[model samples]
Target chain A: MDLQHIRQDFPLLRDNKIVYFDSACQSLRSQSVIDKIVEYYTDYPACGGRSMHKLAARVTEEVDAARATIAKFLNAKKKEEIIFTRNTTEGINLIANSLGFKSGDIVVTSDKEHNSNLIPWQVLAEKLGIKHLIVKSLPDNTFDLAAFETLLKKNKVKLVSIVQTSNLDGVTNPIEQIINVAHQHQALVSIDAAQSAPHEKIDVQKLDADFVVFSGHKMLGPSGTGILYGKQKLLDNLQPFLVGGDTVASSTYTEHEFLPVPEKFEAGLQDYAGIIGLAEAVRYLQKVGLEKIAQQEEELNEYLTTELLKLPKVKILGPEDAKQRGGIVSFYVEKVDVHQIALMLSEQGIMVRSGQHCVHSWFNAHQLKGSVRVSFYFYNTKEEVDRFVRELKKIMNVLL
Target chain B: MFCFIALIVFAILGIFSASHRALAKEAFQCVFRRVTLRACNTGFKEKMQAKILGKLINRSSRVAKFVSHRFELLAWIFFILSIVSTVWVAKGVYDFYVYGNCNGLNSTGFCAFDPKGNNSAVSTISTRPCSLKPPTESDLTLKNVNVSLFPTKNTQAKNKVVLIGCYLCDYTRKAYPLIKKFVTENNVQYTFAHYPTKSASSYLTAYVDCAYQQNKDKFWEWNDKMFASSKEDLFKPEYVQSLLGKEGYDVGKIKACVNSQATKTLVNKQIDQLVGTGVYGTPTLFINGKAFVGPKPYRVYQFGLKPFLFF
Candidate 1:
């Protein structure tokens, strides 16, 4: 890939000098995505799916096109399976609230799941009396498929909700194998692809995950946009999490007929501009190619990991092999505070995420403070990584 | 420890900038946590230190390392210095209020509150070819000066205020009203010995002596009018004669005495007595033997007269 040409598509990268390593938190938007959002606001600023005016018709058409684009991006069987939500958290919350779990129903998650995936199950267990099981990771912080299978065999799990890729360690789970095993147990499988969908191509039909959720902002899309894809049958079976306005087909006093599948799940006034921008983001990602993006990230991660390991007291969080860790290199110094390291890096205009990164359960279980996480995207350059390393070394010299 | 210093610095800076006000609020929270014996979990100190060290590391890693290691120690040193400077400023403000000059009574050092040193300014003694080295506050004395020979009021009163000044000098004009009011209110013995530093105004000193010899109370009234009148008006003989006549003084007889050799001898004797006191400037007052040489604020003269002034 021509990195300079790609960087020109992003206004911040084109205009300023900054090393951005916080893509795991939120990716920067491309100029096309920004233009698409502005177009929605400036050209056809009207209600979608409700009005019959030309502006409304244009909005409805654009929103439908966006849903189709997201469906194509995830390789979903049908466009009807794709539901729009605010973000990954909202998608997971919708599933947790509408999945019809009764008392003693079992739901399983991995130990390293982001709170977006973990906390919904916790609230379910608290309020609905469902059993929430946590499958622990191996010593190297990689997914333990055998242990996950054993848990499935022990419990008649209703749903196996797990992160497709761990945000904490950048380790992709064997989600296909996990779904196959969960199918044998007659349990539905939901995948949290918040960290995976941005870099890797997710074929929902091939994985056969009952539900797949990911955020838009993590893939160069608008911040308040996300996708929740499920089989048409599963989405039809699940009750709507929120019900009002466009969610209904007809309503009279106390009686109402709900809309089908995705419309029923998406309630209230939607973020039309964000949805349009998200489609543009998917188109841009497709043009760039996910495989190339993944390859670029891995190459950058390998160099970063090698340089970081050269320093004393620095410990990478995931597997030692950079290939296994994908684009993320989350680590902690032996005695230094992670915030201090992150803040010092930020002072040098190298933005990285610090603290537990919403994986507080894992960090607390391990009896450790949070680690500094450097998550690379395809736009990042080798020189930026070198600058990050240089500044980190200077910080370590003083801190240690 | 650093939060205490940050709180003071940012709180003062907060007055002029909104951004610093936000930091000041954070510093206050950090300091409150420290005072409550809890760890300062605000991370404000870390944020500030990282910003400082980040700038330093860009230039020199060795210097950054040095500063980081002793950051708390350096904070303590700065904290102590801030406290010392704050106390010094407070003392200056107090001295300026009570003594008119920030450095204390009669000091000529620079005061930020009084940048021009106006409170301590004097119509300086004009240099002459035969004059000795300029007289200082230390050289000012009341000994060997005969105050009994000059105009005296309230002779039995224990407190004495002797003012040796030129009627035409600006500094004396500025101070005379305040001192006259102070002596009258406090019932102190007051003495006025006129010594003209200007040769053009020397003839008026003989007329003042003659007027005092005629009517002592009327002489004081005439003296007040002389200091209050404009310097240009005082140069006209008709204006002086009219002012003396208005004060109910016999202007014709006073003018006659002004030309007499006897009146000149008395004026010369009084100037010699004033000079014997080592007075060197206009508006020099001897309040119970302590000499002050400036147009001081009313409070400073009161402070000089009373030991416990507020009481």
Candidate 2:
């Protein structure tokens, strides 16, 4: 409601001239979380966990506390379920890498994933002699329940990975329905929250996903850090994909043993400052009231998507209903090269992502070139949306 | 005549001074800053569109289930991370653009993506068409040709005049003819002599030793085979003779020669010579010792070669 007050929380908002709309790609960080991270480095910089010293101990405590905070935030069963990762991409890759699927086993995923979700399974399927089946989404970007049911009936599927919200169209999938289908097939589910995590409420327990992966940077946290929330049993069963310092419990030249659960997956010395900042970022969101954040963002989304439709030549993808969508509005204006449009949009100090949004198959299926995607967040406002629409009209007058 | 000469010189100097001042005024700073500006504008527009669309989509729940608090909390955390990732990635990018990776310093610690020194010299290393003073008799001994598509006619003969170093790394076709297909009723026989086996320097050395130095018939035979296909033990010296002998070559003497310190000394000598001329990267062709790096269009090669072939 008080956008001016909200803008004060983010240093990026202080720039009077620029309007940033690509929150699905990455959101602006609040000053409080950023300051907390800076404080950790300047006032109490030390390596987390390998020592008894005050700073080292604090870093370790803060990191674990952050994990606990994230676990609770996700409604995950335990703190141990949250494994810090490079990003959602790495988290999916970890499952695809370590699930130890035997030859002929199937890995089912929806077509709406960012390459982060698609590539790892595709690569792992090829390498491990497993089959990768892509469940098709309807033209509007909603999951085709019949296609998913057909794949589930085959019974060979070992894992099901889906993005909770489509990055391209901002469509919120019937992921809970798919999770139920996967469980019936005795398959584990991995939820990619790269696009969804930043703008929706989630409860991993209710969804019954074996793993839920999301990036901190997409929300307002530090970059190069993400969470891989896995069930403890599955986490224990999985092999370590990256072998390095922190992952090993003990090692000799002949035989080295891996550490248990989260530590085993952590591998090397992490981006400590980033992770510490992310923990503070989590705290900042909690204070803002996640519900208020959602309400504010919805208001912004309602404002932007309507204005986008005013340009007659533009075609918006994803579900037609606002209820089935997040804050993303993906569309392409006729006769404008998506890259050129993106390049032009940049010239006007607006940040939107173009290209297939790293989901190549969706583009291939639609037989369309790339589209322009503008996403929103809590800090965004109606006035900003009006300016953006005016800019679009100007851009259209120039190009279209 | 003196007045005319003074006028021309003054005009030239004035033009140079004016252009220099204009260059000094310079508008755009960096391409990256422009990228950030554009992203901001796009962000603003996206929000406006989402809102208007929301009004239209709320038919049943005109009440609107447009946002989820859970997903929002998730987004906030990820946004924090994106900035950190950008900043974290930026530190190394900055370091790389500066001090670089000299003396084995940890590049990450120094805020570098890798070693800054690695790419720093790349700009300094010229990638332009070289202009030299009139060619001396020593330099213009043979003609140069760049083969864009292979299985070229008289390739065996072409090897002698030009050391054709093929690029298999990029999966450009390496089509060495079958023994049955290569030697026809009237065809040049490509030899398998003096090819390097298993070393990183094999392609360059093979071009030098067999084609340039020896001019053996079996030379291009090995050259095509190397690029056309991949091998398991490409870097091993023992492999050269084993593979080449099967490809049909009488190289008992050549094999012994290649193993000797003399041949190794010669290969080293050639490398030093090329490096001395400041050869930065690979697939470099020294036609009569005049370097042509990367793939050249056949016409360009034809043009450059006509003078030597004619002379």
Candidate 3:
């Protein structure tokens, strides 16, 4: 894959000439994604499932097509299993509220999980009297499979909600093994692929994950669009969290019967433009091929991590092995504030996320200052990584 | 020759006192026409004579005459007063030029005819109101910066996410959802503090606090509506009342509290407290008392709050 050729598709990169390394936070949109969104606004500016007109029918067809495409991309059993949400947070909240965890029922999560996966369960535990169990990570920030197993054995585990990749350090959890362990204990598992989905192809069927949640914006789609894929049997069993206009089948003055699966969960008007844009984003990813995207990110991460390690007083978060990590490399300098470093890098037209990378629990548990996170995507290059390191060295001198 | 010497002195003083240029012109005119020599005095001695005799003559004419005769003593007193006034004016100008404010207090009005020209905290350019606060006090030992006591979504536990914003501000509205997402995503604790831009914003902020007083759940509902409203509809009491009524809130109680002196003081005190901390704009964030101004992208907040999270 030619890096230069792929870089041309992202207008923000070409126009701004910025070295964007904050893909872990949100990905830069390809022109295709932008065009798809524009097409929705200009050609078929109508709500789906609400009207019988040509424009509305076209919108409904396109939205259904996007859903089928997303279902196929994730390898879900059926399109009915794919639920569209505002983002991963809402997706997680829907499941957390619907799962019906009674008092004393334990929901286990990793220290490595993003707050999206962590907080909803925390709120559930507090509000409903359920047990919110946190499985601590190993010293190197790898998932403690042993600790996770111990928690499962000791308690009646209801669900094991975990992140596929640590947004803070890009440490990919051994989720397949985790899924097997949780299944052995008759516990369901949900995966937060917010950090992993963009760089890697997620086959929910192969992994046998009960639920998979990720944001579309993190994967080159527009903001306010995300996917929540649940197994058909599980989606059928769990109660619908949101209820409104489109979610119900039929309503009386006093009561209403809900629609089945995905429609039941997707309440009110959806971000149809964003949903359509997501289909284009997924096509763009598929055209590039997930394996190639993964390979490019690994190569970039290895180079960036190695260069970052060469610098004095730099401490990399998570495992030492770059291959074990995803597309991110986060680190901190001794006696220097990471935000100051980020601002300094920003002045050089190089962008990186500084601080805890939204995994504040990990930093708070470990008692360290937030690290500067440089997350690479397919469009990033060795040259940009070199520029980032050079800028970091300059920033270090200015900061110290 | 004496008049020529006086003219030279007046012109020289005029050149030095450029700020007092009008006064200098008037002095030049007085000296040019050789009008009443009393004009040359700038009313130092004669004004003193008038003040002293006017009071003395009220009681006794003999005493007033005797007092009026002591022009030498009165001249010395006038000379001393003139020197004191000159030093006072010079000090004020020096303070205004060096510190961007006269009287050495940011709260006080600047001196008249100041070259810097009403250097208020808000407008560094020449403008009337003294608006800018001092740099946000990094020292977090204050009464007004209240930590959020309620458990918000994502931040169920006590992890620090202090959001200082104006309810009426557009950026604050845009920022609220992003901030809420960030806070929930990290499972960090959250705090909402007001740094209102509009006078009406203070009441809106107080309404949320009052909502909290009535019901914490209602506070979140009120808070959401405040940020969600269009700029035109944001401060309208009827709109707010309608929203509250939809939520089944006692709008009467809220209305009464809004108008109450106690709640007004509570809101004003909180505003004063934040102002004291040096917050000048909406959407300023303080993660564990680490202050940063303006609304930033998600990544900036993600990484910016890291060090503070541990602390």
Candidate 4:
């Protein structure tokens, strides 16, 4: 891939001199995606599925096209399986509320799940009296498949919701194996692919997970757009979490008939502009290829990790191997505050995420304050990493 | 400690910017927590320190290290300095309100509130070319100065205001009306001692002395008319005589008194008495034995008369 050209696609990287290493939180949108969003407001600004005018018909067609494109991006069985959500949190909440878990049902999750994945199950336990069991990771913070399988076997687990890639450490779990094992116990598997879907290729059909959810903003799309891909039969079986104007086919004062699958799940006026922009983002990613993106990220992460390790008292989170940790390198000095490092770096126009990063449960469990997480995307260059390292070293020299 | 400084700095900055207002709000929260004896968990101090150290570290690591170690001490120093400056500014405002000059009464120092030093300006008595030295405020005195010979009013009133002024001096013109109105309203003993700072106005001084000898009450009315008259009109002898006539004074007799050698000698003696008091400027008023050498505000004269007036 032409890395310089890819960087030029993002106006923030092209126009401004900044090293953005917070892609895990939210990736910068490309020019194409921005243009697509602007196109919706300027050209055909109308409500879809409700109006019968030319603009409305055009909007409905464009929205359908975006859904089809996203369906293809996730490799879902069909377009009907893709449900539009505001973000991963909304997607997780929809499933948590719609799955209809009864009392004493068991739900298994991983230890290092993001709050989006972790909190829903916790709420489920509190509300429905379901058992929320956590499968602890290995010492290196890699997912322990054996512990997960044992938990599935011990408890008659109704559902297994886990984060495929942890925002805390950039550690990718073995979802294929976990999903297969969960299926053996007849437990429904839900994968929080918010971190994975942006940096890696995701084939939901190949993985055969019952549900896969991810955010659009983490993949260079506009914010407030996400997707929940489920098996056709499973989505048809679940109740709609939110029901409003567009979710129903025909309604009277007494009773109402719900729309099929995706439409029934999506309620109210949707973020049409964001959905159109997200589809453009998916197309942009496909053009660049996720494999190349992942490759570039790994190289950048390796260089950053090697340089960070040279500093005294620097302790990296997760596996020491950069490849295992993907594009992220979260670390902290022995005595220095992580916020200081992040803020100091930020003053120099280097953006990195600090604090618990919404993985407070994991940080609190480890009795750690949190780490400075630098996540690289394909647009990030080695020179940016060099600048980050030099700044980090200067801070360390003074602080130590 | 840092939040205290941040609160003040950002609050001032907040007046002009919305982003700084948000930071000011955050600093207020941090300060509230600190005052209640809780930890400043808002991280405002660390955030600000990191921002400062971040810039410092790029320039010199040694300086950054020094600052990092002494951050709390530096915050305390800044907090105390801000407080000191705030109090100092408040005092200046108070002084400006009460004394018409930020530095206090009779101070010719630069005052930001009265930038032109208008409150402390005086119509200087042109020094004698043969005199060896210039007169200072220390030389100013009321000793052996017989003020009874000048035009006097309300002689039985307790508080005394003695004004040494000229008819043509602008500073004296600016002060005379305010002083006349204040003394009239407050029922204070007032003495107008005419010292002809301008040589051209020497005849008016003799004319005033003669007018006082003729009719004491009408003499005050003539004095007020003379001060209110234009500078060009005061220069004209006919206009001066016309004002004395308007005040029902015997203009013909006053003119004879103005030309008489006796009136001239008395005027000279009164001038000598003013010189003995080391009077260096016109509109210099001795209020209750205190020498105020400028066109002070009415409140300042009131304050001079009643030191505990505000209380």
Candidate 5:
């Protein structure tokens, strides 16, 4: 696919001439996605599933279509197994709520996990009597499968959740290895694919994950839209965290009975416009091709990372080979302020993210300040990388 | 030379100020001369003071309107801060109404929603009015009643019925459903009064009398129709019966009632007694010389009407 054609679809980049390098945090929207969101509101303005009107029926059908599309994209066993959620954080909380942990029941996760994955488990461990143990990541900041297995040997471990890719280091975790060992020990494994899914293709059936969560915003979709894919039987066992109008089959002043899984999980009005926009986003990505997007991003990251290393006093963290990683390239200039660098780049029309990237646990574990992340996507060109490098070099000199 | 320069500067400033004052004076004087010269010639007093008062207003406005037009951050911050303080003051106004000890020491007037002062603690001290003994059948006390609790025309019928029945007219609340059902059962001519409700037409008066037509239900129909025909002409006793047939009422029954007018007099006397007992508005109910008035909750109505259930 033509990168120019893909770039044209995003008016933000074209008009501002912005080189967006923060797709990890939030992806740029394609015109198709924007039009779909706007069209859904302005043209057909429907209250989904609320009325017997043509608009409501059509909207309800659209929501179902999105569910099916997302489920098929994730390669889940069934669409019913997929629950629409506000975001990945909510999905994690949903699973955490349902796990029904006892005081001695243990859940294993890695240090490289995002706070979305980490905090729910941590809160659960404290609030419930459950024990949450973190498996130390390897020296390269990748998942240490052996260490995870050793922890799993405790036999009290009932659940294992891994960030399929580290937001901090950008090293892809060995989900295939972890899932194998986890299943051997009769533990249900979950993968937080927030970073991995948009850049790479994910087959949950192939990975054998009991549940997987990833956000729409990270995948060039609108915010407040996310998917929680769970195994049907396990999801059936799991209780929903929030209970409300849609979730209940019937309610009275006295007692209430909950409906089946996905509906029970999604309470309140679903972000109908966001979900519609997200489906278009997914279709746009699919059209460009996820494999091709992955390939192009690797090329950009490799060239960018290689150029970044040539600068003095800059130390690159994570895997050196871009092929092993997603599009993210995080690094810190020895004597530079990350925020200032981000600002400087932003002024140059190069959008990069600075901060802990919301992976505070990894930062705390490694004992390092936040670094600047220059993430590339399929639409980003090599020339944009060259300009970014030049800007970075200038910013470093100014910092010194 | 320096003193000379200072003098020159001050002279220039004074000249400019004085000239501006003269120009403004001349402009106003010109307008006043054009519009009010003849009036002043007639010796009108108020217009003369306006010019004098206008100076003070203009001076104060100069200071108050300073930087106000610019909408700068400093002005905005101060204005917003003052507005927030106003809401805070308004929110705290409940302090003036509470007798003995105020129960709002901890009330935030926010969703943190402390209904009884304390966040989680139940109050030992009562937070309501002292309970008074309701009038019994044997002792019907006509204490001052407030009748302003009925629904206005805009309120839904069910809500109006429920509201009037459940609260203010607690003494005669049973009369509402009884009168309403009776009107429907009797096929009494009545329509809910929508607008211009104060003009007391003779037709409306006849309807009220008819509602008291040994049939409790006609009273509701009478009240509904009377308040609805709110024209001053309709209030005249001479044409009141004639106006009754205007809104599709039985003119003959109304006219005959008016010709005798005994029932109308009784209804009027009852209304006067209700008003005398301080039954100022809608839903004022007089039962056995007892006055029940004012809006109350649904539970209050259910409880208040309990004694009159069998009656």
Candidate 6:
């Protein structure tokens, strides 16, 4: 509970006097994470595994170390199971393209998925003339597992892709259960853990998911860093998404041979600094303990949710309980513009996100106004919540 | 060859100066119909031929006969080449004017002639200062603050000031007094947001959250201490407790709240809320959401705010 000590690690929290509540969108960079990246840029800024020079060797070593760390963090069976990607979007796109979906094959996803997960499947289905199916969420904003199972049973579903945690609602899906059901029907599952990986501990082997995609920036790592974890066997069988110089083993004018699964998929020079920074971020997270971080976020989320609900005009979106909600509390005011409230809070030096929370389909379907979202992290405090509520009341008085 | 070129130049000059009777009619016709000027030599070509043939006849009659027989063919070829060369040069000049280069490749080396010396008049360029000027009420373009749920209609006694600065930043801390003076003197409106520019700014911003929860009224006092203290002593629990302890505040409660997850989450939310607000560094000041570059002189505010208030 010594956040002052913990807060010392994050420079942004120390320097900026404003209350920050938008960790779900992107977490602030920590000092250790920054140092790791700076080390790469300042000391050994060279291509990894491409040269025999000392700098290249150093870069290769750090890259290998990062790969091993990520493999262990995600609990991948083998180090080769993890692949570095630019971000979650690229990772999902890789899976969507490489998995070899055919015409008439169905890809199932939940209604609460982010656009990164949704758009890739939609494009895949369109390009290959395949079927993209959705498993609708219940009124409480939790996944409809039964409907998902029914869809899997009814169709020859090639893949079941879903978000491990909904970014908009901060609702963690029952991914383990969903994966189990998909496996029962012999359908492979790809979990978009962009929201979950930073906040929760992920074990690919434990979940028995075929693929997992998550971003580094969302988890206090560099912007372009991300990981796409797939089983070694599946990765070996899947086609490479991108192909170029480092990807090939040998080539003639007439034909070319690919090197291997991960390299063939990498295609270009990777973001070495970002990858190294992500490994450092994982180290930082491990030291802090994801469990403790999750607990802190949950506590803060509960406090904010309770305070927001007390307002007669405010309506909470997603699950009402904090345990289910994780770290985000989104709500819209009655007879007032949510964005205006966000502006007023901003004017008071309190920051909260406003709009559809990038869940346009869900918002549109539910006939709800874009809500003011107060997302929490380990660095948030109760006083900020109070100030935000006080400011909200003041703005409400003027507007209402 | 020089005489032949001079004769052609003279004939073209005759077209420009029609009053010049010294220019023979044959030479005038030769300029117009150069191809059909068999009898219109104006004695220039004949004199040149006679001079050349006279020397050639003395040296060898066969060579002189060959030269006189092919003279008309050689003359037509020379005339056609001169016209084509003139057009090519003109095209190069036109390209140079349009594209700032004569050759299609834009390399000055390829230009038929390097026109570099011709366009050497120094252009006097004037520019406004890179910094923003304080606006008068009539001159100021009012933009909606664009925050959701903020009422746009009412303009009353409320003075809205948005201070964008990092709590832990040395620059922001130093600028705080000037800002405080401005805020107190004007009494228009006041609010502040975190824009941490320092290495460990996030922690400083989060600490404010903890202090604010313990006693909302004393938040500003705790903030002043944060600015006043050295960066080294800023994060120490004992130092924070000692600073707030003088104000009859519960040190233990404030410490516990500061250490809580709530403070961390609030800090992160603030960072996200102001993500695209153009707040890269500390000490960014805004009035009614219109931004003004911070750490500016006190006079900037004196002038910047004076117009809006007077109007």
Q: Each candidate's lDDT (Cα)?
A: 0.89, 0.64, 0.76, 0.90, 0.65, 0.73
Tens-digit per-residue lDDT, B100-181, candidate 5:
0122321223322223422212111111122364222233234453223222222232222222221112222333454345
DockQ score for candidate 4: 0.68
For candidate 5, give fnat to 2 decimals: 0.00
| C-alpha lDDT of residue A394 in model 1 | 81
Candidate 1 lDDT over B1-311, as tens digits, reads 98999999999999999999999999999999999999999889988888788888889889999989999999999999999999999989978877788887777899999899888887765521245676667878889888887888789999999998887878888888898888888978999887776776777878777888999877887888888899999888899999988888888898898999998788878877777787777888889998877888888888888858756
Quote the positional error of residue A35 for candidate 3 in Å: 0.5
lDDT of 4 by residue, A134-239 (tens): 9999999999988888888888988889899889989899989999999999999999999999999999989998999999999998999999999999999999
lDDT winner between candidates 3 and 4: 4
DockQ of each: 0.66, 0.01, 0.01, 0.68, 0.01, 0.00
Q: Which ten residues in a row have the lowest lDDT in candidate 3 chain A?
A: A391-400
Error of 1 at B149 (Å): 4.1
Identify the runs in model 5 with alpha carbons over 4 angstroms from their true place: B1-311
Return whichever of 2 and 5 wins on lDDT: 5
Model 1 lDDT per residue over A71-130, tens place: 999888888999999999999998999889999999999999899988899888899899
For candidate 3, write residues A22-91 as lDDT tens digits.
Answer: 9999999999999999999999989899899999999999999999999999998899989999999888
Q: For candidate 5 chain B, which ten residues in a row score worst on lDDT?
A: B120-129
Model 3 DockQ class: incorrect
Candidate 6 local lDDT, B1-311, one digit each (tens): 32344346566677678733344444455454555555443444554454455455446656756766676776666767767877877777754543334552113244544444221111111111122643222222224333221111123337666676665565566667887888778756565665556444455565566666566667776666767788778656577678888876887887777778867776666555554453444455676555554354465455456644423
Per-candidate TM vs. native? 0.93, 0.57, 0.58, 0.96, 0.56, 0.56
DockQ of candidate 2? 0.01
Better of 2 and 6 by DockQ: 2
What DockQ would candidate 3 receive versus the native complex?
0.01
Off by over 4 Å in 6: B1-311
lDDT of 2 by residue, B1-311 (tens): 11122223334455679753332222112222334553223232233223322332234222222322132443455556655876766665543323233212112233233323222221111222244643222342223312211123356454322232323322112212322132232243222222222246354454336333343455556655555545544555456556566667545755666666766776665444433443333323343345433333232233233434423
> Pick by TM-score: which candidate is best?
4
Instruction: Report, for candidate 2, the interface RMSD.
Output: 12.9
